[model samples]
Target: MKNLDLKKHYIFFIGEELPQPEAHLVQSTNAANAAANLGYSTVLVYLQKGLKAIKPANLARPFQPRETPTELVKYYNLHDKLKVVPLPMPWPIDNFRSKFTDSNTIASKYYLPFHILPTTKLVHSRNWNFVKAAIKNGVPAIYEHHHHEDKPFELEIVNNPLLQIAVTVVDSIRETMIANGMPEDKVIRLHNGFNRLFMQRQPEKAAEWRQKLLSNERSYLVVYAGALQQFKGIDVLIDVAIKMPNVQFVCAGGKPPEVEHYQQLTKEKQVQNITFLGYVLHHELASLLQAADILAHPHCSGKAATFTSPLKLFDYFASGTPIVATEIPSLIEFKDTRAIAAWCEPDNSHKFAECLKQVLETHPRKIEGYSDSIEFVKQFSWENRAAKILSYVEESLRPLLIT
Candidate 1:
């Protein structure tokens, strides 16, 4: 922290551990990697202690001297230029803390902002507490919100003079923030993006995956990739698989426990056509997607459905495969829904199966309007998203720099 020139450095603060299966970790690490690739002197700061304390194996191993750990680089496919700094948690308090007074919260809220304030030109983070702390200390900060829930003391935080911007992943979130008195000019809606690497199609690799995934009986493959949560409509996907006995349905993302639970659920329901591939690497996702005949986005309706932006949706677009998705508010707002996907009603397995059947029967294996989807997704690349956000920040801070 000593020799850093503030003007040359940009800090991205995250409260979670890297190399996790969560979408947030994927989004944050990729954004930082994109910023670094754009030639910003970027540093990604995360906690050494996550929601839980470091494991015994991690304790036994010596600390990594490199700026970015090897595991993280392989896991997230991060750029070498991006620096990673893990802030240590408070000693005894972290070792022993109650749920109400958690150490991760303490470090993120109180320690991280002060630690990076003097070292960085601008702070970008999804953690509201970290952003609030940075803004309170007069450091320029950009806060990105993904969820629909309102933060405590939201108005006070948004109105801070040093708060450079507030970014939301969907229009509903932006509208909600504005309805709560956040300045219209200070808030922007930017969707989560797909990695640029996804655009590079690996035909041989995709063929290999198709060979491995497809069977003699089931000539067509329908794939869904992302968290295997109930809200994400994995249950509905199962029902769809049950209805379509001859088509192979594969899910390509989930933790081990989640995979086990769903596998058990399938067994109980006697659903034979479905398979779950737990936690595929980010780099391999593109090839896996290309192997699919059709990609499914079956998110259910509820509070989460209103504001959630599925990262996989962008990747699916990039895959050049036809998409079968539910007609949720978030998907409807994209304007290109009809252009990129075949829509069905949320939480309705019968309708979803009928929609998939229509797509399968109509297209064979190739996608309709494939060129349009590819062209449309060009603007939603990770590099473009990062550049747009960074440019806005620089433009907003120009007057401050002039003075």
Candidate 2:
């Protein structure tokens, strides 16, 4: 193991085991990679407990050091500059708790503050406990909030003088934090972004995927590329698929169990047009979105639906494909924007199907008022997102340094 410099920026997340197909992991890794590329020495620290228990193949070579940048690059499409550090929970306790509780909670709250925070120059994380710990231990911290959760300690933590910034993905979240007694100036809203290197117009690759997915009968391909949870509107997508038998539908993400369950549901319903291509790699996603005639974001109405920022939305925009999405609060801003091709009420499968059909039929011919999508999505690249956030952090720290 190489000695880590305390001057480097440390981004910590008590995440799931490595290389898992999860959105949060994607966001954190991309931020770290971008920060490193921007010439900041950055290290991404995540928990790797339960790997031996969950993935038996790891037992062949037990508890090796952190995965190399090469391995991470292959798995995450990361650049070579970023450093990844995986921390393991205590041995016997981890084995016992792995069955009953989330190891992330224990490790983040108890282990990380004492072992990792003291060595970090600046800490950035999504975990509330980890961020709180960093501030408590006298390290400058940044908290990135993604969801609308009721945390009792949130107000105290965000208001702490040691905390440099609180970043939210939507304006509503920043508003909520301010209403709950957080300092107005300390919080800012910045949306998620897409990987520009991969998520661009790839005409030749798009044609290849179109050749494979489309047939003589089914000329159009509609895609939904995200988690296959009920709240994510997979059920609504299934209902829409039932209504539109002529349009070929494909889902590009989900865990194995979720994929199996959805597959059975579609089978029971006797729906023949929809297929689940579970857990497509990040780099391959752009070509898949490019291959689509229309992209679907059928999120159902819920607490998560109100404030959630779906990473797939940006990726869909980057592909330059027309988008059909539910008019949830978080996504409503894009309704009038050129990014979305069509919009419908949340969880209304009939309306969703009708909207998708209208877009599919009218596309390849401009959709009247909407501008060019590729040009519209140019500002939402991952590098640009990271640069903006880091600039904010630097500005906030400048006065302290001057004194």
Task: Choose the strongest candidate by lDDT.
Answer: 1
Error of 2 at 347 (Å): 2.0
Clashing pairs in 2: none
Cα lDDT of model 2 by residue, 159-225, tens digit: 7777878888888788777776668888888888877655545677777888888778887789999
lDDT of each: 0.77, 0.74
Clashes of each: 0, 0
Model 1 lDDT tens row, 1-403: 4443344457788886566898888898988888888777777877675533455543443122237888887777676878877655534654565743565566555554545555567788888777877777767888887776654446777777678778888888888878767789898998888887666777888888889988899989999999999999999999999999999999988989999999999999999999999988867888888788889999899988988777889888888888888878888865454445578889999999998989987756652326656777888888889888866665634211210
Candidate 1 worst ten-residue window by lDDT: 394-403
